[model samples]
Target: MEIFPAVARVTFDGQVRSFDPSVERTEMERGLPKQRLLNSQVLVKQSMTLYFASIGDATTFESWYFDVIKRIGWFEMVHPYSGQTIKARFENGALGDLVPDEKLTGDFKMDTVVEYMR
Candidate 1:
């Protein structure tokens, strides 16, 4: 018998972190006719912001960080919170500039708006 280890993480092109991937969803609805639902737009392909936080004492700098941070294209994402591996694209991302005196470690955070591609 074969088994896989239980892993909870957020990953992009190999950069991995064992943390909750915050998934945001837009309530597609109209403010009329008793607030009707607009549509059930696949759920994944709708506009969303992915929140990723590093584990304690860990640096945000990863080998695949740049490619994920700078590149503009669709990529696969493993969302621990949603429990689904979905296709998404980077709409925007932000990180405060690392200072000389400040240490670069732990809980380095970034929130990005990603539109599901597939």
Candidate 2:
């Protein structure tokens, strides 16, 4: 039985990103890991902090950040610049994961996914 993981495609600021990877599970567990998958899609609204490591003074760029989905359904990001924090609500658009998974061994594969509100 070959079961494939679900794929999530998200768009923001007129850009579309796709995430295709398997959900993580422990050796003793039979279900997916509780953590959000890397490359998973999410939504972000205005007033949300888009964090990035600037090249000198430039602030924003096309990049990816690992964000956490809050219970209130907002996305929180730690500004890589100021070290301050910011958040995006479900009202704006969507966010997604763009990080790739690391292959530990030949048969062992572990990855993460993101959650979003639509």
Candidate 3:
């Protein structure tokens, strides 16, 4: 399994978590609705913001993102919300952009969304 690049001295923001349950529902004409789980495992999605303290750190991550992930489309990393290692992929095939520091400093920030593939 390929691990995400561990850029040093980066600040990690709290993850915004969401999930989609694998369920099917049916409504009876004269009774309560019935639901059944199609799959045991749900799909987990998380959005995370990373603040790179330096350009070097940002470049390292960018390289890995484009070279490794963009090609393979998925990788293993520690889940920001669950605190456990999981297989993940870029959400909706969207590759996030690296925004530079507003003050012209050699810093960068990136907001990314990842889906947990159980």
Candidate 4:
């Protein structure tokens, strides 16, 4: 799968701006009387945000993304940072927020964050 192409497009959202994804590794640990021991260590979450810049792009993105949010499932994407294809979904709350900047009346940008377990 193609990782982050300087700029890339997805099956759902076309022509997007993406930055390096955030990958997290988390574990549970406990401390003993004399030493420390690890309990559970595993990859926790991988997250990335895709930006839809432009009113037309934002509108299309909103429709597609909100649709996914309504359903309870994961979508597919090529992770930008890890260079791997992963099953991901929109981050828990507030799927997409589109607010027009002062410079343009209709021009706007919206960012959608997604998370994956890999």
lDDT of each: 0.38, 0.30, 0.74, 0.48
Candidate with best lDDT: 3
Rank order (by lDDT, best first) = 3, 4, 1, 2
| Candidate 2 ranges beyond 4 A from true positions | 1-72, 90-93, 97-118
TM-score winner, 2 or 4: 4
lDDT of 4 by residue, 2-109 (tens): 223222233333334343334344454754334343333323343334443466676665555455445345666666655577776555644445556455565554
Q: What does candidate 2's lDDT look like per residue over 17-117, in tens digits?
A: 23335356445466654654554544432222222222211111222222223222444543323444545333322433333323222211112223233
Query: Over the stretch 1-118, how does candidate 1's per-residue lDDT look in tens digits?
Result: 1111122123342232232233444555665333334454533323322223344212333323454345454556655446676665544533333322222333333333445532
Give the C-alpha lDDT of model 4: 0.48
Question: Candidate 3: what lDDT?
Answer: 0.74
Task: For each candidate, give its TM-score against the true structure.
Answer: 0.36, 0.20, 0.81, 0.50
Q: List the residue pairs that clash in candidate 4.
A: none
Which segments of model 3 are wrong by more than 4 Å? 8-14, 101-104
Whole-model lDDT, candidate 1? Answer: 0.38
Off by over 4 Å in 4: 1-43, 46-49, 68-71, 101-107
lDDT of candidate 3 over 47-98, digit per residue (tens): 8877777888988877887777774477887766557888887788674677
lDDT of 3 at 22: 80
